[model samples]
Target chain A: MSQTDIASRLGWVAVDWGTSNLRLWAMDADDGILARAESDLGLNKINDGGFETVLRDLVAGWLPDTLSDDNSISVIVCGMAGAKQGWCEAPYATVPARPETLAAGAVKPVLKQAGLDVHILPGLCQVDDPDVMRGEETQLVGFMADHPDFAGWVCLPGTHSKWARIANGTISGFRTYMSGEVFALLSQQSILRHSMQGADDAAAFENAIRHISVKPKELLHCLFGIRAGGLVSPDGQQAGAGAAILSGYVIGSEIADIMARLGRDESIALIGAGKLASLYRQALHVHDFDAEIIDAESATLGGLRRAHAALTKS
Target chain B: MSQTDIASRLGWVAVDWGTSNLRLWAMDADDGILARAESDLGLNKINDGGFETVLRDLVAGWLPDTLSDDNSISVIVCGMAGAKQGWCEAPYATVPARPETLAAGAVKPVLKQAGLDVHILPGLCQVDDPDVMRGEETQLVGFMADHPDFAGWVCLPGTHSKWARIANGTISGFRTYMSGEVFALLSQQSILRHSMQGADDAAAFENAIRHISVKPKELLHCLFGIRAGGLVSPDGQQAGAGAAILSGYVIGSEIADIMARLGRDESIALIGAGKLASLYRQALHVHDFDAEIIDAESATLGGLRRAHAALTKS
Candidate 1:
């Protein structure tokens, strides 16, 4: 095969380290993932000195096979691994750093070891509003790889949901919402969680979307009613779920706000895992936009690999 | 001294018992509050069995000597004391029930000790939807007492901010915003609380209100920037006060919805302690309407006594 294939079969290791879990992917040089190792050893568990050892043990086997004569392996990283608690808070590279211009940043790889080189990609950020991000950073690279002419809004929905306004092969501005995290906390952990059971009841949720999307003004008042709805309700068990309905109500209202601001003509793409993207797609369609959901993991993997390839060449 | 004084004093004992504090005002033959006792024995402390004992100790000295001569001395009670955790969960009187009507159908009070007469006013509620009020019941009654000819909206700002519409002497509808509670929790007890040191910065808060009232739409994006406003700010102590700004933003937005629905002609009156009422009046005026902030403690005391008098007459 090609040099990329050789690298693919023995692909360098990639890590999607999040707040709770660390997912490791081994890909061939051709950019195809071969084997994967995952663990609950996320940044949260690294405790004090355990990050290196934990990550070391998780990928101890996959590393050797991926190395080439160049004495280096293409290691791409993303997610909270860049946070203070992460494996290492690799700094972010400001905008205008294209796939070709992206940097091959520093990584604190396992020490006292040999035969491997690591390339952790820098996160993309807006200078004016430095705290916001486009996780589609790498994904945009992959998106660009797939559709060189692609430009518009690339919406990434997750724990901290991100919406990026993409233009001219570059991401210009983006905003983040605690949408997914808020959903989880309100739906399962918050006091409103239990009352909203059987949320799988699509009919109830559909009816809810309609209610919130149309009368956004009623959202705040409707939320407090969640508890009251349960108090005077014939179905006491539905109280928590009804409270969650308020969760959906708030989310739907926020989405409606974004939709209105984005206007009708811009292209909307829902980028994330299936279920989340699907939900956003459904919410967006109400505004008459046909949005499609993209697999976040794949986008992340492709995006990272492309960045590594571009930065090394540059 | 006067007709209103006679009605206020000799009516009966009026009590507002909540989770944290217990307040009781004893009216004389003239409906003037002859004696008042406030105690730390809030319902939260009663657990399961001591509600009666705690309440008795608070009011034993204030009880009228002539009480029980015929039917014993009657009292009107409201607030969380009538909730499930209180003496008894006085059933909610669905919407359209005035203070006079709700007091008439209070739950049957159980006598735990010798020579004790007590009655708990039921909570006011909405039947078509699920919302209830206990303390505000007295406030609404008091509002009517003070402004016998008043019509339109009365805004009560506190832990739970309430906006009630009164037309033709009846409360037609109301909406509750958790703005006050949200402010307390975020600025006092939450993770954000630690990040903020809003200590003694009324100036920051006042300036924030001006900003919010001036450009209302900044609310959607400003939430995330709160951290930046203070952290990246030269003023560390002012960071905490940012919540006040956020509080103003949310409250202002809520008022916008109300003003839009009612149009400018509706007279908006503020009924509460002066400082709290002033904050709301400014928020309302920013949206282009003048609001009158009325002293409410006396009115509420007057209201509870009025209800007790009406009950005794009935």
Candidate 2:
């Protein structure tokens, strides 16, 4: 279909606007994705009051040329785009709360564009332990949509990985680990960078996970060991062993901590895609906890659809 | 005195050249300081074969104009300047060995300057555990010089902090923690940076230390708490509380691990100066361990003097 045809068929828009990027999906009346678009202009890059302009420009092709209230498209946004510094602040809805009811807490941002009707979803917050999540709440909503009675933990691995507890169709609480960011900084910026130049080694990764699992307190010591290992026997180790060990040590530490708190009796719903998901799955296996990988994109879209349905009804 | 007068009185030079900076102390026959100099031209900045020129330029004023073998000055160097990529490779002296005997493993680099006899002190390494320390071994020697029979732990805090076991006049083993570096990366480079601004709070620091001590496995979770605490109660927290909490958490985790591995029955000799030393001392006190602060400069100079005396005798 041409741009006009897709625009005529578009019933609404879905956006996952995060810290570093923006993703959009054009949905038809039946909730089918008619078209999709994305940009690097995430929350971090936009200036004050520039969000609407950026969004309008990005979705202009998906909107009908004729301007009227009846033709205005509903744009549902999730993630940091609803943060205080985002396009317009959508205050956090405190838990324990059902993800489907999050639409009640959503805020509508007034737009200068005539054909765009935007609703930003509220993130979740836990006051007692002091924790928060934006984008992952929608992912949880999507996961719950498929498995309405699912319980236990959901692990979303990323720069700041989130591990959430779900029971009775509501998120009880969650914890965020800076493990992914820490890994990047250690591998690319720290002294360990020198030792981490080789390709990935599965054996080295698994061994490091086991090592950290047995002695989790020696994390800092283990990090320095990567550098010292290369120094002591410069020619003895296999290529890429350092990188693999560093990755294993970081992810292993995160998993180890979670296991220590929750135990490894129940399997985890690992909600992510690509290499990060696979790595978390492998790391989870090291702890003898089976992980079922779920597609992140599908969850995000399903979440937007659920929220959109709730918005239309109310 | 004039430059020439100081140069004439100079008996030898003691150097501590680390990865990021260089420090030199000119000494008389009695090991009394004649003059001192420093440069930002550390090991990281100097290219291969350029160490000689940088050192010569920094210490040119401290050396006599007339060059002769009779007036040859012995330059005792320690730290990363003696690493594999340094001016000369001073191979590591394995532990379970006295720091005083480190001079035996010192490597002499062939230099272009005729009046300078340079000996780079060897670092300490542990093969089994895979750990290494360059300049710190000299500091250990210095501490030993002052308290020859003192048997306890010596904590040298820095970007990479070292905690060593001292018994039988030998360093049995040591562990290095990258706590300081991790703190820097998180407070200045990570998402926590935004919430870390404000004055230092002692109470907040101590409270965070106690919090981490109770739930050590929740370290990664505690890190993200710093950010969430700011987000949830943005107006309630004291200025600089986030920074204090972050500092407390990172250092507390390191100290907690040490306490877990080795009980807190013995007092520790803390060898460092400035804010970092005081911070570590405070953190150590929180664990009910008394810390005796020893000036880092005094220890480095004393260690170099011990090494120099040994070199002259040999």
TM-scores, all models, native as reference: 0.83, 0.95
Best candidate according to TM-score: 2
Tens-place lDDT per residue, model 1, A1-314, is 44344343674677777667878887777767777778887676777666657766776666555444467665667766665555666666665555654445535555445545555555665545423442456666666566556566777876666677766666666665545544554455434444564444444445566776666556546656665666676475444367336546655765765665584456777767666677777667656778766677777777777766665565
Pairs that clash in candidate 2: A198-A240, B198-B240
Off by over 4 Å in 2: A65-67, A263-265, B2-8, B58-60, B63-67, B263-265
> What are the Cα lDDT values of the candidates?
0.64, 0.88
DockQ of each: 0.27, 0.71
Who wins the DockQ comparison?
A: 2
Docking tier of model 1: it is: acceptable
lDDT of 1 by residue, B1-314 (tens): 44344333444667888778878877776776666778877877777778777776776666544445364666677777788767888887776756677667676567765555577877777756577677787788888877777778888887767778886777877777655654554455433454454543556555555664444434434444454344334354445576666666566656655765684456888888766677777777665678877777776776677677777677
